[model samples]
Target: MSSELPAFSWPTDPSLQPAIAPVPTERITPEWAWGGSTGLGMKVCIVDSGVDGDHRAIGGMLRGGAVVEETDDGVEVTEGTHSDLFGHGTACAGIIHSIAPDAEIYSARVLGKNLKGYGSTFVAGLQWALDNGMNVINVSMSTSKQDFAGILREVADQAYFSNRIIVAAANNTAVYSYPWLFSSVISVACHAEPDPFTFYYNPDPPVEFTAPGVDVDMAWAGGKRATGTGNSFAAPHIAGIIALILAKHPTLTPFQIKSVMYYTAKNVRTELAAAEEEKRDE
Candidate 1:
């Protein structure tokens, strides 16, 4: 006997339309965005060399992680706890942890001990993060290869539509890079500022934000600490802040979160001065 499949149908007229709750404030401020948020329930994935769970800076906040390896059958992602091949991933994790200590951090180690890896491996790691229900993905490294551009764009678009935010770092040099160049991701670069919480949103295209990256102290592998500077470090600062926002407003989509960031950005806050004044008058 043949069995009938369940019917799949769209909502009828009486069905309520999908909608997000309106933000209570007319003007988005830092206080309104993530003032007291501790990033309690957010899941952040760092796609990099790897993350050292034992690092002091991590503070035992790592939930789990995966390692992407190259085998005869192509790329393989093994899920479990992993160590940072290089210190890059640990540094990124430290930044995010410092900003959002309560958020769960997971690592997708794609790079090798040399701090480099194949583009295909990077893609696989990113795909792993997307499939594993990561709320935010920190991509401090990017591939400049033209062959991977199409796939990277596709993945970035998927993250955008899936309510998963990908905070990418722009290349430190003048060279080009994938994913970060896409509008679907939040691209960040290094600023000379020392304050981690002080970030600026650029009005230009591609690079949308700037965060502290110069001489920033970070958690290194082997239970040590180090200072470094690069766009790589900058991306996690934004990623951490994004975690805070997601923690407070769990229902918000990626685009809505970006709008909130734009409004609360250090540079953009001046434009909201008039709005704040108007609100005070009421």
Candidate 2:
């Protein structure tokens, strides 16, 4: 004599597809932007694979900073090229520069040559970025689990204390990812033409905002042009947007700026999702 129990399944309706909002045209729409342009002399730090400081798209954007980390000998790991050997970081930096042409980008090499590294390195990079007075920090990488939330809160707290903002790439999977999942941080989702030929896709929820990710044309290492995927490519878009927001609303707190983005985002997904739902119901 067992009791019946109900089962649960994730939303399957096509209408539930993550909708993507179109990139903003105003260069600044979040009321925060009333303060100024994205770059406007603000400094942003990108903690990921190193960036190629010589890339054309990054001409004036690269900050040309050095990485300082503790080594086996207790000395700082400071020797290495600033070049983004894997091309991932350089691409992220390019997107940031495009939106905030005046913002300077500083890269902290944490992922190493393979574009992979330890959580310790990521933390170390954050410390470096903060110590360097970065106005915004873009973290494009994540760990295997959603455990980085606390660390993100701590970092965001420190940045907040210093009047800086920390933006991160939302995980690519359907599940949650760290730093991005941390409510204290601004989590940016990837958005672009699903098919290279298509214009764009509907926006996704739980995602605070969207940026160019799919088929996104950008700069690469060795002065090359390339296209690729990943939330890594999307984080910088928010970073740049935040910079512009700060430039305009110099008095707005990082938290307040984030709020403005949510309310001001051009929600192209809402209607798209409704139409898809009607079709499904029919």
Candidate 3:
């Protein structure tokens, strides 16, 4: 007797067409278990000071992006200028690239040209990201304007429904900021972790995630690098991780991605355990 079993084959019929079955979304699990995905083919918009694509830390590559400008009439969108006005944008870009090296980074300059014309420029940059079909947007800057908060909330929600993940940095101080404080966007703050990839999830409101932001060595403009600390650096770490997740699992919705970030965080279990302990004591 043969030890091997014969495989079953489908019957061939000239009169019948082959039917393909579609897999259900809920039943599918992403391949993030294996852990080898770059942000290749993903468009990540850095809506801050522009990025210098030639920076060594960025690997001398970037997707061509638009620069928002303010004129006497109104905000205008222009192309062919992706140079970082200040070094802040470059620093953020370097962190994102360090994690998702192949992600298609784009610059949407909205700040630091003079900081005087930020309102319109900020709106224009975000609008550009939405209009251009960005997969992920990293917003390291936020406005404290309460009057514009409602509109910004709507904008963030629109991106959420569109599957465009926006990772925003919480305000360093106790003062409020738009977009980041909104429930739709992922809000990140600082932690003491020295590893660039290390991140934690907070159970608190407003600040949902904490990544390495204390005295981090980052890339700056003019092909230079520096050590800095703030919630600004923390936002990009989550953004980069998101880029990796989106690369491996492009089908994941914004909600699903947020869940992944929360559950896979290094400190989630610890945080939950501590909360449970406190509740038991109470």
Encode model 3's per-residue lDDT on 1-282: one tens digit a residue. 965546754446645546643444323323441168788878888998888888999986587788888888888898766688888888999999998999988889887655334666777788799889999999998998776777788789899999999999999899888789988899999998898767887887879999999999999888999999999999999999899888887887888787777666777645666886999999
Give candidate 3 misplaced runs (Cα > 4 Å): 1-34, 114-117, 269-282
lDDT of each: 0.92, 0.71, 0.83
Per-candidate TM-scores read: 0.90, 0.75, 0.83
Off by over 4 Å in 2: 1-38, 68-70, 74-81, 145-149, 193-206, 268-282
Deviation (Å) of 192 in candidate 3: 1.3
Clash number for each model: 0, 13, 0
Comparing 1 and 3 on TM-score, the stronger one = 1
Model 1 agreement with the true structure over 100-200: per-residue lDDT tens digits = 99999999999999998998999999999999999999999999999999999999999999999999999999988988999999999989999888999
Order of candidates by lDDT, top first? 1, 3, 2
By TM-score rank, best first, the candidates go: 1, 3, 2
Supply the global lDDT for candidate 3: 0.83
Segments in model 1 whose C-alpha atoms lie over 4 Å from true places: 1-16, 274-282
How far residue 50's Cα lies from its native spot in candidate 2, in Å, is 0.8
Best by lDDT: 1
Candidate 1 differs from the real structure by a C-alpha RMSD in angstroms, to one decimal, of 4.8
